[model samples]
Target: MDAFYASVEQRDNPDLRGKPIAVGGLGGRGVIAAASYEARKFGVRSAMPSRVALRKCPTLLFVKPTFEKYKAVSNEINAIFHRYTSIVEPLSLDEAFLDVTYSKYEMQSATLIAQEIKNDIRNELSLIASAGVSYNKFLAKIASDQDKPDGLFVIPPEEGPTFIKQLPIEDFFGVGKVTAEKMKANNIFVGEDLLAYSKIELQQMFGKTGSFLYGIARGIDHRKVKATRIRKSVGAEQTFSENINDEISINEKFTQVFEKWWERYENHKLKGRTVTLKIRNFEFETITRSITETEYITNKSDVRQKLTDLMRESIVAGVPIRLIGVSISGFEIEETDTEVQQLTFW
Candidate 1:
């Protein structure tokens, strides 16, 4: 998928097609969720600062996101995937990884499967997609972006090395700007340069990420494509409207967050025990705190109490907090019947 949300918006609304559009915030401190291909020409990109995106593409259309509509479209596309294979792992509302190794469609070629899927998306939904075909997940992911806005790219196993060799270090997966700059400083700019180093040498220099980099350089990825991914955890975190580090201010913010969670999800009858707390310092050192409760809890207040206690103990007064989050996991729901509810009330 490419510019998934923006593409969906453009598909439903004729006016936005071929125009630069952004799907998320257009205000201060907002980050780009998706950028249209037209917007990308002006240097607008997803996860970029919204202010900077405007600076890049001043006339870009800003559409308040319609997640429900997008979700509906997502389900339709997912049905097409299911027709081919049951092993589909959705990465987001837009993107998914499907293993067609044993598909029902009898499609032997990954490239062809990609082509048919792209066609279905365009003809039925009036949207475009970019596809990558490769033997493994990492390589497949890298392949998917080779073309954009209704394009298909393939990376055959034999040609994988040569393709990766010329790619910039910055363009490689998991190499962020800071890491790219570090690699540049070390005079490692391309896959070939990355491949030149022994695994031991790379490990000593880059530490934990060294082995990962080495594997990508040689196209030696061994990661599995898991379709039945369990919901190990469910959590939400926010970078504040304005970043706040003061413990008291963050606690207040936590209360605010808790209040919202309580109002909305509490009534839905969700159950989870192991509550986890996450905090990010001003500099982005993340810390997590977790507590298990005895109850089959659903109310947000109980979750909030666990949250506040965790925050109170962990937060230091002077530090500026950049982000905070709460998560629940490790349980199953006991569905309530109407009779049970009436009995409890009585």
Candidate 2:
């Protein structure tokens, strides 16, 4: 899936095709959820402020996000993956990792499997996808981004070390902006630079994360592609136009959030024993309070009572509340017909 939300909008609308379009909220504090490739050329990107995106591309078309449609497309792709392999690990609504080690088709070529998957997505879903074929997840993820829009890239086991050595430190898995800066300060700017240090030295410098970086630098990732991901929680939150301090307005917002949470919970057919209340104050302080009950919480009264108690403890007369969220966790999920059991080799 390429530029997922924006692409969906473009695919369904004739006028938006091959045009600069952004999909997200269109408010004063709105942010770009996704930007089309056409919009990217104008410096628009996801998570960028809408105002900033407009400044960069004045003619950019702003469309509200349609998550239901995205999820439907995601489910369609998941079904397609299950046709080839059961070992699928979804990274998000748009991307996933499929372990075709023991594919149902018994295909020996991972490259061919990737090609078929990309082709199916294009032909069936009216969408384009870029795929990366590699022996391990770390390398596969890096390879996927090597080419953009509609591309397929592969890294063979024998060529992985050499390929990784040439990559910059920022391109490494789990190396974010802050970590990249720290690596640059320590003169670790590329895989070759990172590999030059001893494992013990890296561990001493970066603690537990140093071990992870060291293994990936050497092109060693032992992680398996897990098939079934248990969703432990479902929650919803709302940001107010203005900070709220009164009890009536607070409860009203909680009721709205509860409706959303319940909708999601029922959709997943899940029940939980724990309820968590999250509060963000006008001063930007965030707080969470959770309680685990003997019986699974299933009704509005149970959730509202717990949330109200937590709010009472956090809300002050003068302090205004900026955000409120309610969540249910510590739940068990039963397997459904749609989910395929993951197969592991080793």
Taking all chains together, the TM-score of candidate 2 against the true structure is: 0.75
Q: Each prediction's Cα lDDT score?
A: 0.76, 0.84
Q: Which residue pairs show backbone clashes in model 1?
A: 132-144, 245-320, 245-321
lDDT of 2 by residue, 1-346 (tens): 7898898899999999999999984875567889999999999999787788999999999998888999999999999999999899997888899999998999999999999999999999999999999999989989999998898999999999899899998998667787889989999888989888888999898876788778888888877888867665678888787788888998888788878877877776768888788888876677888998888777767667777788888777778987888788767653242222222110
lDDT of 2: 0.84
After superposition, candidate 1 runs with Cα above 4 Å error = 206-208, 230-233, 239-249, 258-323, 326-346
- Clash pairs, candidate 2, are none
Best by lDDT: 2
lDDT of 2 at 331: 70
Q: Compare the candidates by TM-score and give the number of the best one.
A: 2
Error of 2 at 288 (Å): 10
